[model samples]
Target: MDTMRERFASVTSRLLDEDPRLAVVLADIGVDGFAAAARRHPDRVVNVGIREQLLIGVGGGLALTGLRPIMHTFASFLVERPFEQVKLDFGHQGVGGVLVSAGASYDWPSGGFTHMAPGDVALLDTLDDWTVHVPGHPDEAEALLRHAAAAGDDRVYVRLSVQTNSAPRAVDGARFSRLREGRRGVVVAVGPLLDNVLAATEGMDVTVLYATTVRPFDGAALRAATGLADAADVVLVEPYLAGTSTRFANDALADRPHRVLGLGVGRRELRRYGQLDEHLAAHGLDPRGLRERIAGFLTSAARA
Candidate 1:
C-alpha cells in the first residue's frame, strides 16, 4: 500500500482506468500530487478550485448523472465548513461517492487545529444510512475502498491518516467482527489503537473486536456476547472519546463491566501537537500506556 495521498491518487487512477465515468473533483488543497493522476486520466478528473461547498455539489451532480465521483480535500474543509452542502446534497440523498478525507486527526498540527477534524465522526454520524470508516493502515484503506465499491452503499465516508499497515484484522465480517469461535468481551479498538490491543493481548485468551464502522456497530456481535459469553474486564481504547467506542459498546454490551480509558480529543481543545507519536502519547494511547493497562489487568487477574 502506498502513502495515504498515494493511495487516494492510485485508487482514483484505477477507478478512472476502469470506468471513464469516474472523476476526482479536487478542492484547492487536495490537488498537488493528484493532479498528475487527473491529467493522465484526462476526462475522468476535474479540479474545482476552492469552493468546498461546490465541490460536494458538483460531486453530487456527477453521482446523480450516473458517474462516480471521488471528492478530495482536508477533512475540515470538506465536512466542517461546507457542512450545509454535505448535509443537504449528499447526506440527505445518500449520494454514492467516496470522500477521501485526508488528515482526519491532525496528521500535521502546523496546519493548525482548524484544519484538524477531531469531530469528523460526530459530523457525519448524524446522517442516516451512511457508511463511515476510519482506516488505521494503508492496506485496510485500499481493501475498504474495494469493499465499499462492491457493497453498493451510497453516502460512504472513509477517514484516513498517514499511516503504514499496522493494525491487525481482529474483526472479520464486513458487517461485524468474526464471531467464528467465541466472544469473550467487548475489547473495543478504534484506528491505530488496534496495534496496541493486538500487542497487549498477543498470547492471551482474549477476544478483541475492532471496527472503523463504530457507528451502527455490529449489534449482532454485541447480542452474541450478552449470554454466558463474556470475559470479566471489558476494555475499550478509543482514539477519541469513550462514546465513539464505549457508548456504542455499552449500548451493545449492557450490564457488562465496560471500562473506557483512551484519550478524548473532541471533548475539549486539542493540544498543540504535530507528531502522531506525540499526539498518541499525550492522549494516553502510546504503546507504553496501552501496555500498562493490559499488564495491570493481567497482574490483577493472576492475583484473582
Candidate 2:
C-alpha cells in the first residue's frame, strides 16, 4: 500500500482534474508529486518556493477570489513557521481553505527537530472553527482530503502521517467510531496509533474509540460510552503532543465527574536521530509501552 503522502499526491492530482474550483499551493516540498497536475493546471497548481508564509498567503489570496485552495508543506514549516500567516490569512480574514501537512511529529527524524511538528494540532486548537483531520490510513486520508477540498469556505486541516494502521476504518471525517465496548473506561486512539492501542488494550475491558477527525470532537460518543460506567476514566492516545485534547475531553464531560489521561509525544526534544520505531518507543507510544501506561492508568483509576 502507498503511504499517505503518496496517496495525497495521486488523489489530489485526480481532484485537480475533477474540480476546477479547487487549487493547490505548495512551498517546493511536494512539487515533484504534482508535476503532471501542475502541467495540466498551471494557473491553479502553484509552488511559492521556500517561503512558507507566502505559501499560505497565496492560498488565502486564492480563497478570496472564490477558489478553494489546498496548501501543502512539511508540518513544521506549514503550521509553526507561518502560524501568523495561518491566523491572519485564513482566520482573521474569515476566508476558508485547506491546510494539508506532512512530516508528522518525527516522520523523518534525521531531518532533526526542525522538520517535526508534534504541536501543530495544539497550536491550531488556539484558533476557532478550524476542523482538524488526522487520518490513520491512506484510504481514510483520501476520503478526508476530498471532504476538505470541497468544504467550501470552511477552514480545515488534514494531517498526513507516515505511520498508519494495518487496515482502514470507515471514517466519515466526523465523529468517533466505537470499536469496542467496556464499562471500565474509554481509550480514544487518534490516527496511526490504533493498531498499537488495540494491541495494548487486548483482553482489557475498556471501550476503544477511534478518532480521525478530532476537532469538533465526538463528545456525544464519549459521553454515551462513559455514561454507563460508575465513573468515566478516559485515556487519550494521540500521535501528536501529549494532552493536546485533554481540554476538549474535559469540556465534553464537564457536567459529570471524570478523569482523563493524555498520552502522546513528550515536550522534551529527542536530539538523537533515530528510526521512527525507536522514536515511538521512546515516547511510550509503542504497544509494549502503551500497555504498561494504559494498564497502570486504568488500574489506579479502579482503586480510586
Q: Which candidate is the best by TM-score?
A: 2
lDDT of 2 by residue, 186-289 (tens): 99999999999999999989999999999989999899989866569999999999999999899999999999999999999999999999999999999999
Tell me each candidate's TM-score.
0.82, 0.99
Please report, as a residue range, the 10-residue window in candidate 1 with the lowest summed lDDT.
Answer: 178-187
Clashes of 2: 0
Best by lDDT: 2
- What lDDT does candidate 1 reach at residue 203? 60
Model 2 Cα shift for residue 234 (angstroms): 0.1
Q: Give the Cα-based TM-score of candidate 2 against the true structure.
A: 0.99
Task: After superposing candidate 1 on the true structure, give the runs of residues whose Cα lies further than 4 Å from its correct spot.
Answer: 151-153, 165-173, 176-184, 201-205, 225-233, 254-266, 291-304
The stretch of ten residues in a row with the least summed lDDT in candidate 2 is: 222-231
Please give the lDDT score at residue 255 for candidate 2: 93
Q: After superposing candidate 2, which stretches have Cα over 4 Å from the reference?
A: none
